[model samples]
Target: MSFEERDHTADILMHIRAADTIGLFTDAGHALMKTMYRGPARPIEEVSVTITGQSLEHLLHGFLSELLFESEVQNIVFCEFEFQIRDGEVRAILRGEPFDPAIHGGGTEVKGISWYGLSIRQEQNEYACDVLFDV
Candidate 1:
């Protein structure tokens, strides 16, 4: 489903489930979908997160990595996420704060989100994806 056409809760759940499935095989990835508000978008806030999916690892890493990408590239906090996962690919509409040294990670730099070490396959009506985060 498109980010605009998805149910927030369902999208988050799917991402989590996908991450969890990956965790079952290995602990090298995370999945997250969130939309930030209060900063640029309306009704969203910083330090806010909505976790979905049954995959814990994917949810965690995906959230953080997306945050990392925002901080470094966009110089935003991106505390909120509007998430959708389809065919193993996650589409997120993120909103958060601008770069602040206080919230930034120390001595840790996120390389990027990689298609490597990951897979997305269709399983009936649902899409399954295993993604690896580059830390």
Candidate 2:
């Protein structure tokens, strides 16, 4: 699984591709991490969450939004994601450490994850999606 930054006029757009549903959600975290912090950080701190949504898109947005909340509130930038999504429910454990401005500040700050243009779809054996990060 992998994620790539794409051009956007007002926000950060990331195209994520993975082998399965879980991978799609997992890579989304990496995409967010890449957008928010440039420096390398170890997974010393852990954040866990269990959330539910109305639909797939809602679940995705909710999950990403939760991560964003943790990042800002805890002053941490996550580097790893482990998620289980089923029946509109998500249980996840994320790893990150305190954000050090000296090393992590060069990256753009993601204020929020946008609902606009957010979508997840399956093509063949792979899952692909796009998420917009409001910065």
Candidate 3:
């Protein structure tokens, strides 16, 4: 799993790649965490969520948006995840600890996932996408 960031005018553009569906989404989650928080994130708490979307791009957007919302509301930075997708439904188990400024702060504040360049594609054995994150 790998992702790279490009500086946009006022936001961050990320291109993520992985070998499979699970890795693609998993790395995307990590990308979000890496953009928003930097710390020794441990699995102190576990949370589960279900999200539905019409397509893979929608699912990815919803998943990332949900992570941002969860971090703000729960004061957590999720670093671990288990994802399962079927029939346009996604189930995820997220694990991380509550936010601590001393440990989990000081990264770029990602306001939201942008829709402008959001896309997903698969080629042979790899999956990749371009995500523009609003900062």
**What TM-score, over all chains together, does every model reach?**
0.38, 0.94, 0.95
List where candidate 1 sits over 4 angstroms from the true fold. Answer: 1-70, 83-92, 121-128
What is candidate 1's lDDT per residue for 15-125, written digit by digit as tens? 222233323222222222223212232324444334454443355445556565555566564434455544434555565556545544343344555444344444665
Candidate ranking under TM-score, highest first, comes to 3, 2, 1
What is the overall TM-score of model 3 with all chains considered together? 0.95
Q: Which one is best on TM-score?
A: 3
Candidate 2 local Cα displacement, residue 129, angstroms: 0.8
- Pitting candidate 2 against candidate 3, the one with the higher lDDT is 3
- How many clashes show up in model 1? 25
lDDT of 3 by residue, 1-135 (tens): 599987788888888889988899999899989989987899989889899999988999999999889988888889899999997999999999988899987898988999977878887889989888788
Q: Which candidate leads in lDDT?
A: 3
Go through the candidates in order and give the C-alpha RMSD of each one to the true structure: 12.4, 1.1, 1.0
lDDT of 2 by residue, 30-51 (tens): 8888888888889999999987
Name the weakest run of 10 consecutive residues (lDDT summed) in model 1. Answer: 24-33
Task: In angstroms, give how far residue 110 of model 2 lies from its true place.
Answer: 1.5
Greater-TM-score candidate between 1 and 3: 3
C-alpha RMSD between model 3 and the true structure: 1.0
Candidate 3 minimal-lDDT segment of 10 residues:
116-125
